[model samples]
Target: MRDTLRTRVRLVGATMAVSIALLVAVESALAHEEYVVDGERDVAVGEFLAESLTDPFVVGPLLAGAVLVLVGIAGYLVVPPVERDVGAFRAAMGEYRSYVPWLLRISFGIPLIGAGFGGYFISPAVHVQARLLQVALGFLLLFGFATRVVALLTLGCYLIGVVVRPILLLQLEFVGGMLAIALIGSGRPSADHVLQRVAGTPGTLYGRLDIVHDRARVFQERIREYRTLVPTIVRLGLGSTFVSLGLGQKILRPGIGLAVVDKYELTTVVPASPELWVLGAGLAEIGLGLALVGGFFTRASAASAIGVFSLTLFALPDDPVLAHVGLFGLASVLLITGSGPYAIDRRLEPVETEEPADAVPEAA
Candidate 1:
């Protein structure tokens, strides 16, 4: 039992390590279609949708894929996991819970700084300079100084920009990143933790100087109970982002997707027709997005998202790496949190009842 538990822990660690590696390695190909492809050259949306939808080749495969997914879901719900294995896995994962806030901070911080320096407004596609605002927010988030304040500021900026330029919606995952950070606050190794310690310590120089620490502590305490919603918020935000990208960017606007495929010569990599490539990619994203939103197989969905982001980087040499840094971080957070609260996984968990002390133990 101990050996099996150890092996599962090692496997989980290895999977996360590889996922992070892939995210870091695929930096060269991370830019989105809106950044490179010219919008004026795009085909009419009506024409593209009609042609793609009517094609038997595309529709047939998509239908079949949907059916397979439905069947898989049914099977998963009917089959029960080994209770011992589930317990071991959950125990292994429980140790990482404290790191969730740190993960959320890094995920939002770096991308925000990149966007500021890169001359974008929360999204790579929206080329509006708010460098000072974003950079300040990013630095504060990374430093874990007034982290919740910074997160709220980040969300506010993104929302205001969305009102001005609806295209900013492409990077909707920022919403999740910010909300999660706001809820979790800066975990250990942050300036917030250090400041809190100093302010709480008697006769410390920093403690005497700290004016807002008490108020901040009060605020953090009030919100701590709601932290469990972090995972659900992340799932919804990231899932919707994926759904929009798949449907709006690819299926609804194939001209742009095809341009990307042609420019990158993606056909050579997969040996498939350009239409199939576009359709398949779109469908795959939608499937992954739905799984995430539903919180079904949450960890696997997140891992797959990380894989997809990395694969895109490898496939598209011109894709800007900074644009996707946040996405990599958000997916990593999901990998850590799994399907927190209100998830299908939660409902699927087996109930455990206490056994009498006199009950005999069964042999493994």
Candidate 2:
């Protein structure tokens, strides 16, 4: 049974990877198209909109939905003469569910890369816009794949871009990106599979009881092992975000740190003179990022850093739709996941207790 499940998982992964690659190829082609022709932008836009209406945006999802239906049909056909066993059906469905994250990553990543490259090649204004879009899309992809750290970093880029420049184009981009992320994030699998696997048995009163006890023990052990580590992760995240922003702000305009802030008027957020607010914001960011990296007061640092980014969303409401969307998504991940596995929390965990004390208590 385990082997079968593993095989199915591998198949699903392979299919998902292929699907993502195909989607990326399509997006890359579109990006190249923009750079290849002069008058082609309008034509390209028209074709893209038309294609979106006819194909992947509509037809492609329909096709995928149809494939799912076929899987259901096949499962029914394979069921035995007696009562139909749902184990295999459930396994197949689980495999499909597991494939979703990979698919979303590919879907978001390819276009972002294409857009980034396109931006770099286009006029300076377009280049700046494209980079912001790239950061937003990249964060959305990472968030879709449960890589919270990567998402946060990308989001930082987006937010900084806005703080540096607050304009109408950037605002629209932010909104668009947010909507995309919302669409992707709304469909996550439940945690039930993790519980079932850890329990090592199907549903039964005794089995459930054992699973619960095991989970509780595991949770306690993990907490003891990584008590200090969790805080460290948060601190590192905070420090990195702050440092990046501080450096950027110190050298560039406050609007420069944020992309949308610069899209309109070139004036800096800090008035004409010394620009103390920009410098202060930068220093704070550096402190927060360094603290996070050092593994101190991690949760607080992460929370603060996230709050800073959230504020940027409001500060540069006129930033591009994609940029705002990306930052929002990135901030959400940092708030939820913190630093993840590599942080100090993993290192500080206490050693596991060999047996329950009651099982082998010392004889009186």
Candidate 3:
């Protein structure tokens, strides 16, 4: 019974994650279509819904939904019908308890850093001091996640000292990062224990209560573990869609950037030489997409991309709804999820200590 419940929870979480990912991909494809036809196009929710509901594209969502259903069904079939061991179940639950808070940190930290950089780049003179503070905050956040108590304390102090603090936003990244680390550091609960617990339980009040409490505890732990990651994931999905569309325009239509800028009347005072900037921006976006997908130096790359997108938003502030919305979404994602599973950081754990050379001690 416990094994069954645990499997059910895993299936549910995985399904939801995949579904969200598919939805984002569908939205991205639509955004690309709009970008190609009209550089300065806007998409309304109703129109988007109607269009997505049609052929070919509709298949994507349907497939994702189907996969989710299948997983749920599989979980139902595979989960055993027995009472599980309590002690082992508790141990399993404890393993993942710390993951939630860390995830929340990352989700929030990425954005706060980006916003600081965006502000810095937009008007250096005006935001120089603010930019420095933000950069400092970002580093402190990274350090905090790596188990630096001093960094965490400093962050706390800064939060209290700042009069009009954007505490919620900052906390979001901090929490997300912390949760992800915890999750990775402490893997899933013991499948064997869960199976045992389920096998032992019969249909009594105590048995039911044990099952209910275990399920609830595990569910809460999973929720806490994933809640921070979810926002970041959402941001990544939306950001990837917009960035991909923007890149598509450049690829499909060579002079799409200039055309887009002109159509949007983005530059009241266009640069005497705009081609270079446009091309550079396009290339930068392509690189950003790759970095995001690859998850290399995720926080830094995402921050830089956010800076670029934010600048675009300012330049073409009066553009169509989708453009602004897309840019906002991209910036949000970069801010929220610095880099996910695909990130290179995952493979870059520091070497704790070097092994001694293969030399034997002479004459002791």
Screening candidate 1 with a backbone cut-off below 3 angstroms (N, C-alpha, C), the clashing residue pairs are 30-319, 31-319, 31-320
Q: Worst 10-residue stretch by lDDT in candidate 1?
A: 355-364
Best by TM-score: 1
User: Among these predicted structures, which one has the highest lDDT?
Assistant: 1
Regions more than 4 Å wrong, model 1: 1-33, 79-90, 350-364
Q: By lDDT, highest first, what's the ranking?
A: 1, 3, 2
Model 1: per-residue lDDT, tens digit, 224-318? Answer: 44555677777877776777678767776677788888888888987767777788888788788878878888877899999999998888777
Worst 10 residues of 3 by lDDT: 355-364
lDDT of 3 at 315: 64
List per-prediction Cα lDDT, in the order shown.
0.71, 0.38, 0.40
Model 2 residue 294 lDDT? 52
Name the candidate, 1 or 3, with the larger lDDT value.
1
Candidate 2, residues 1-364, lDDT tens digits: the string is: 6875565445334433432332223222222111111222122334433443454444444456558756854564475333234334333333343233333344335545655755631122245546666755554564443332233444455445443432212222222233223222313332223333445556656556653546544544433332222222223323433454454333222333322223422245534222233334555565655655554433445466657767765565543333323333333333433343344533432231112212211100
RMSD of 1: 11.1
